[model samples]
Target: MKELSTLCYIEKDGKYLMLHRTVKGNDVNRDKWIGVGGHFEKNESPEECLLREVKEETGYTLTSWQYRGIVTFVYGEDTIEYMFLFTADGFEGTQISCDEGELEWVEKAAIYDLNLWEGDKIFLRLLEENHPFFSLKLVYDTDDVLQYAALDGKRLWL
Candidate 1:
């Protein structure tokens, strides 16, 4: 089955709001630190999904955000996901406790030290570089190991 989702990295000062995916027992991202987002609701546009998810997950309404890229995740032979990526620098509201996991502002440089999917590292680099909007495809084995990566149809060695 194919799924559509949105992910947002909210930046403040020199840190990014991150979620530690430890509360969900069956989560695909269990124990990993990742950006905020979730699956798209019926008929929701990317921006709509981004705004709703940001609010639902982080309790912040995004006032300024950039549509960063589209990421296609191929998981073995069973599932495919198109994830719309975003980054936000402006928001309003008091942060609330998330039911999904603990939320914290992590130093951008220290994000790499956390447990993350290998393909995430690649896209994180792209985000850091302030690259133009692009498309990325990440293929993973059944074990969730990143096996191949491509950006805009061009194969990436890493």
Candidate 2:
């Protein structure tokens, strides 16, 4: 199993900064909207991973970020990846498109309309509720169905 880290940057206008993935593939989540982030390279901290990813993906510099949650995906017999999720309210630079997809500012109220992982929506809702900082561990099965979820470090409604 390998672990990955990602950052979810929220803009100051109460909108979420997201990436619209246009990659065509068999992955069910492809061609969908996702957070601006990716897997971390060697020796990269979660913050470093996020800053680099945001810069690479949209040319923005993020700040005042806080760890929010972790999600795990299990595929088939032996595939697993842990995703570290973070949130931020401050950033610099204008948005730019990347090879991954187009960058968009999704309104806070309409985020549910976009195509996103079911478990991700849950965490997104948590972020909107202003949980401050916390960690969520979500387990998924081979079929990409959620199995369980647990949290630590803060109290959340979900």
How do the predictions measure up, each by TM-score? 0.99, 0.83
Per-residue alpha-carbon lDDT of model 2 for 13-33, expressed as tens digits? 878887877865564557778
Q: What would the per-residue lDDT of candidate 1 be over residues 1-158, giving only the tens digit for each residue?
A: 99999999999999999999989889999999999999999999999999999999888999999999999999989999999999999999999988899999999999999998999999999999999999999999999899999999999996
Poorly placed runs, candidate 2 (over 4 Å):
24-28, 152-158
Q: How good is model 1 by TM-score?
A: 0.99
lDDT of prediction 1 = 0.95
lDDT for each candidate structure? 0.95, 0.75
The superposed Cα distance between candidate 2 and the true structure at residue 36, in angstroms, equals 0.5
Cα displacement (angstroms), candidate 2, residue 51, comes to 0.6
Worst 10 residues of 1 by lDDT: 22-31
